[model samples]
Target chain A: MAAGDSGEDKLIARLFGSVATHPGALGLKDDAALLAVPPGHELVLTKDALVAGVHFFPDDPPASIARKAMRVNLSDLAAKGADPLGVLLAFAIPPDMDAAALEAFAGGIGADATLYGAPLLGGDTVRTPGPFTVSITALGAVPTGQMVRRATARPGEAIVVSGTIGDSALGLALRLDPARSGFAGLDSASLDHLRDRYLHPRPRLALARPLRGRASAAMDVSDGLVGDLRKLLSASGVAGTIEASRVPFSAAARAAIAAEPALLETALTGGDDYEILAVMPDHEVSAFSTFATAAGIGVSVIGHTHEGEGLSVRDGDGAELTLARGSFSHF
Target chain B: MAAGDSGEDKLIARLFGSVATHPGALGLKDDAALLAVPPGHELVLTKDALVAGVHFFPDDPPASIARKAMRVNLSDLAAKGADPLGVLLAFAIPPDMDAAALEAFAGGIGADATLYGAPLLGGDTVRTPGPFTVSITALGAVPTGQMVRRATARPGEAIVVSGTIGDSALGLALRLDPARSGFAGLDSASLDHLRDRYLHPRPRLALARPLRGRASAAMDVSDGLVGDLRKLLSASGVAGTIEASRVPFSAAARAAIAAEPALLETALTGGDDYEILAVMPDHEVSAFSTFATAAGIGVSVIGHTHEGEGLSVRDGDGAELTLARGSFSHF
Candidate 1:
């Protein structure tokens, strides 16, 4: 990172200007970006921040860190059933940060912005006392009044989640304490799968259009399924019953859990799963599943909404199970 | 300042839920905010970040810190000729921060959001190891194709500024080293006036409408006027000649400079002056000035754009003045 104001300006123009292809971005020379929302389309706004040593290790790959910053917000947009348009990034780093590292980080951000079709609109970079951090504010658009929300679920609706869960949690476990994770029996490939999931999350953006047209309510599960489901139920003034056995888990996660039964709790309440959780009428389940499967993403029916209050999870034998904790939190 | 996931959720709901009253905000229960852009309107986006011990004193009132975070972005919207619609905040703070401080910060943010008519749409809060930081992305709306740009200045256009410019810079000097600020001769009220300017910046939002209709180019002077004007001229592919004598200063600022002549450079090149700098056709200057005056804001012609390459500042005698530096730099 550069030390002064002129250096900061020059750094922005040289490192970030190329991504400001949108005309309204004004080539990033203007103070604010101009975004023309198509008629009848409403904008979706979401922001997420990643702090070194908390969100990711300080030595983590710059590309992965950048991708994570963008993906978290992308996950929010996906849950809202909107397509991303652009993003503004704010970076705070120690003044002594390597210039090459900053370049790599920007390159990664630009790469993901291009991949997700969310062009870089503009950004602010500044010096921090310690612990580099990145904050991304992503903008998207959906048809007027069509955004899927968490408070619209109703009784008798089927709760579905896109893609498998628990991998990220297990991945973190392995990354933090490989030997103590009790995954020694797992094959190397399984360990790699868990680790990779922790590094990058695939937001269910492809399901946005389908969910927007049919789902009653939706949100991205970032803070563990049980806790997030409870939040969703509370917001909708409803309750839910989730089948523990039906909660999708990747083969790697299944093996790791099989090696240690206590891992189930971690799978249940250890967040960082960037997958879409949606509620829809039971009648639309089959069609939605088919469409989702055809698109190469799994859509599993794991629960149902009810008129009561909180959330409960049932075991394979249909007996309600208790959890040690509800969700992953950073306070 | 909660300690875990559930705690974080509770904190957000308890402190911020009421402010997310916009229907599109979905009561702060959704993954992203939905904004229905009125027909024929475009969104203006800008993001600014403030770091503890960098942007402001870490001991500054939490409310002032929060207000500064939002006001800096509001200043950007003002320069863009847009009316703020909403704001999204991202906060990364030390986990051990006092709960009372967080409450005060939130209250301050809420107050400013209300005062600026930019409601809080959504925000993300997370834990940082050290150095608390706040990043605000403010969204605004302007009639389609009406956003003012910094690259639109043409030769022969008159350069204008809304409000006095040097108070903030001088105020910062006094705050940093009170005894050396050369303010001992000033009355207590004048000292307070300078200090207050440093703490709170009044963004020129009211000038947006008139500037949109008439200004050839516009930008907010966050950096010093000399550097910012150079940037504007560079972006517009034009040059300018500024009359230093015409640069406006507050009475307190003039008094301080009279006591220490060298403080003039600090007033000219030191940044943090959140005033609006604009260019307009000579013919529109009178009308624009009349409208600005009626709005109770001062508008002064300090320069003129020309078909050249760089900026030059001249005194009342037509002799060029030398500057130690063009602008305040953070590098």
Candidate 2:
């Protein structure tokens, strides 16, 4: 390393590895990161690219951007009950980005990698135009027949979710257009939580291990719970009924929702929740809270699966709310 | 199953299984794409992004750009002698690009993927500014004990190249900045070959299987031969000697080189070659050619490995020639 070399590379080098790592990665110093799967286990490999404007705000803080990129990938691994082995990051840095910003970005990536216990193996970095992008390809391992999929939810399954939903979308509302209600009157602590959810949402990797063969249809709530749950139901070939009142919301979230009635709609439709939604057999419903508690996470009974056609929200009186569907429509 | 509907859930239907395809990817309807990996063999992945103006000229044909992106990734897979299973492409199209051009780009990707027997598994798309960046991550499989590494080259091994060197860089020079003497009066056929070499060089996937149990040190020649070979030498902790007269150049390339003595230097030092460079004991030389021939590829020798530090090139008389050490230094 030269005294006046590019500082970002040096910082990235300092952060690419966690505790123990593959010996080959240490020696190769090449761009292709290498991971050795454990014996008797299969690997689940996933890749995701976060573009500057499309995925995140153009002026998003580099630290938050880095954390979000890693977190989104972790969300995928979490959905499958997969153990983190390592990851490869392919980044395109704009020419204008200074070495300091790049250093911070790399530091954030290192921090998240360390948090998730996933090593940063190897990657290639190149220069690009104004709106840059970061693509992370995460590799994980799971014992054969233990990984979860989004297609096995039985018709009479119980729909469940970990953590509160809509905070991330609410946070985006504040960041992009402050005129949107609910977020404007948020308390300091609530404000902080919202930002964290938007910028560095935690992936439920720890919960994945225990949910191994238990959860039926499972996936992370990326595009808001209602929206994501609809897709889950669709994939499972079952319809779902999520009680709007039974939906769990933080105390602060409830207060915010009260301030802006429109906030409920945003929370239901706005994307980027990143919580995990799983469908389990009706008997599994009684065990949901206990399982989540044992895993040191919270679980909420968000809905019920039925052998019907479309997603429906209901009230205490068991009357359908008349809303058409659950979440974001890509079309 | 709807009336005349293609069943494609628009972009959302394509999101899942976009990377690390699940075996039952097709089952995740109306939302995510699903394609699964087979058991036993783990995945070896590599990604590279090419920006339009930064990577190729703005006027460069979109199909060529698309092919080049896939080629670059395939070259990486070839370096490991891994079998091409599938690929994930993350392409950023400039908003100003013509719709036909974008279609051509996608067609080019589909065409090449089919050509190499590697299908397009999944990917994400977005809009970017002028320099259109195309990022591709290629996945391949190698037997547990067969994948080659760059760190295994030993001292006293012969440094050999799979094909003639310096053509691509010379070809690049002709396409970009055509005022050079070698291309100033070139015909379209000559220019087209040069452009194709620069634009869509083939990745030697077929050689991967045979090279797996062989090739002490190996890597694709993305940079010019001298420079890339230097990487192999450095990674292997050895040095090399280049037989300049033995360096195979195309007929037109030689004629072009004759027009300007410096053209040889460009060919020698320029990159984007996409060939393979390996180090092996003298005895394995014949086997490589035979293997390559059977695989329907080309191979040639241009150098020998030495005991010490830097690269040395010799002319027909076997005396060192005065030229730059390597091509495309990391500026």
Candidate 3:
């Protein structure tokens, strides 16, 4: 019954069809898209799914949710040092979701895809008897054999991270707290800054070129710094130590930590940072930092890779600190 | 707090990591996969999502659900005349789902991927506050510019379909019926056969090579033969007529229809056939049929294409028939 009218055909044409710009998309009419792999390049593939109530508040704006979905996958590609080509989306919408919400979600994804120069190639939309779920599979390109990968870092390499961390975690705290305005001394502007950071992730696309040439291993920090760093170390079969004080944090995050000392552990182990953690030789750090600075982003050397496995966090005095929880998990 | 223990990391290593056999998969260690597209081949990409209670019964066995998920996407690739390379899965599980269910789901998908030569590449698993949802993106390869397209059919071409058309729809009927066992003269074996058709789709991968060189236009029958044929004709700017008698049906479907003649329309338009429907010149039909027979699959010429629009169905007495509802839709 819905097939002839309000189903997939209408939804595609009305909301998301315009974003299928690539010739391979076949105007979103065909069963599959035909993508021509660029000459001398390899394709990078990544998938990420966002679920309502888990990944985001159920009432979060549809547009923001859409952007977050695409941004997270883009962050994965960015970590791999790949140039994004396009994305395929798979959406499962709750029966109660209105047309306005669906339209807003499509509009948001289309805007983000166009903004990032990666058009929507194809997608599947289905009905779910539950929360709205958005799953995206992003395709990217990198010159053959040039994809930056985890497990390639050598012992003694410096561990560098792109941009500041922990803002998103702190922002999420404020969002979940009932007495949101009771922060110790954080100004309204700082509060908004933290909230925005949680709502919108700034994926480090500009660092791809620099990291591809300089970094020995890389991964995006979706988990907390300590946790994600530990994963990278395990993958590379190397250990690392981070000076807790050296891990860059936003002014708002600093103020929150100052107000609640316990928040420092949350800052270290809180997920959703979306920053790029990279391992590079000490000599290449200055040049990489310079390039990142020119690109209007910050780069910090938090520690160095060692011969063993797992991550160690040290205070300013080199005293190792224990974390209650190492990373974020969905299980 | 599920991030540290029961969530992604542990689940992946225990359940799915071993399925990453291809070099591109990187053993699921990296953030993304590096796919080296073969020289002189283009990639075909398709995404499909199945939601519990919508696509399948929430209580269906995990293996059958996994197989159906992969088969639907494989059917899309088969229609496009593409060789499937790999698949990326995204799963959102309800909090109520036990570890056994999660393990069973992963095991089922892994087995299907191996069976299809579409090894697991990488995936994202998350928690959902609703029903289980599985989304997959399948990648396929075809020689440059050789993908069978839906808009290339010409007037005066023979329309053909592989396998029976409505067994799955009939199977669904029996599944939904409260008096499922009261069907007149239907034995348990016949009922199981019909239900199996609904649970497992046989994607025509063998048809790819034959159709690639012969079919003028092609697509998989997903939304029922009548509705899908209408789509193909619309895309190709042509019309077609089908002889209801020539439309293929399985023995079980024929028996069920004999018991209730009104079900003929449902057999023709209830969807979920997952069969290949192609348009080719009349001259190519015989050779194609022969090749398909040699490959151990049935091929039936049920209609012809003409220079017009929409699909026309003719009954036994040459009288035209109209379907009340032409396909299944989720809206």
Q: TM-score for each prediction?
A: 0.97, 0.90, 0.96
Ranking by lDDT: 3, 1, 2
Model 2 vs. true fold: TM: 0.90
What is the TM-score of chain A, computed separately for every candidate? 0.95, 0.90, 0.95
Question: Model 2, A70-184: lDDT tens per residue?
Answer: 8887887788778887776777878778767777787787788788987766666776765768877666777877778776777877888888877887777667776666767
lDDT of candidate 1 over A44-150, digit per residue (tens):
99988889988888888888899989998999999989999899989997766776887788888888888888888886888898798999999999998899988
The residue ranges of model 3 lying beyond 4 angstroms of the native Cα positions read A1-4, A7-9, A178-182, B1-4, B7-12, B178-182
Q: Per-residue error at B76 for model 3, in Å?
A: 0.3
lDDT of 2 by residue, B1-331 (tens): 0001123323322332342233423322322223344455555667777766666777878888888888888887788877887776666656686666766776777678778866665555555553577777777776765567776777777777766666778777886678888876667787777777877888888778767767887888876787677767776788888888888787667877888888988888788888887777878878888989887777777788878877888898989877755656332
Residue B18 displacement (Å), model 2: 12
* Candidates 2 and 3, the one with greater lDDT: 3
Q: What is the fraction of true interface contacts found in candidate 1? A: 0.85
Q: Second chain TM-score per prediction? A: 0.96, 0.87, 0.95
- lDDT-wise, the better of 1 and 2 is 1
**Count of clashes, each model:** 7, 18, 3
The DockQ-based order of candidates, best leading, equals 3, 1, 2
Q: Of models 1 and 3, which has the larger DockQ?
A: 3
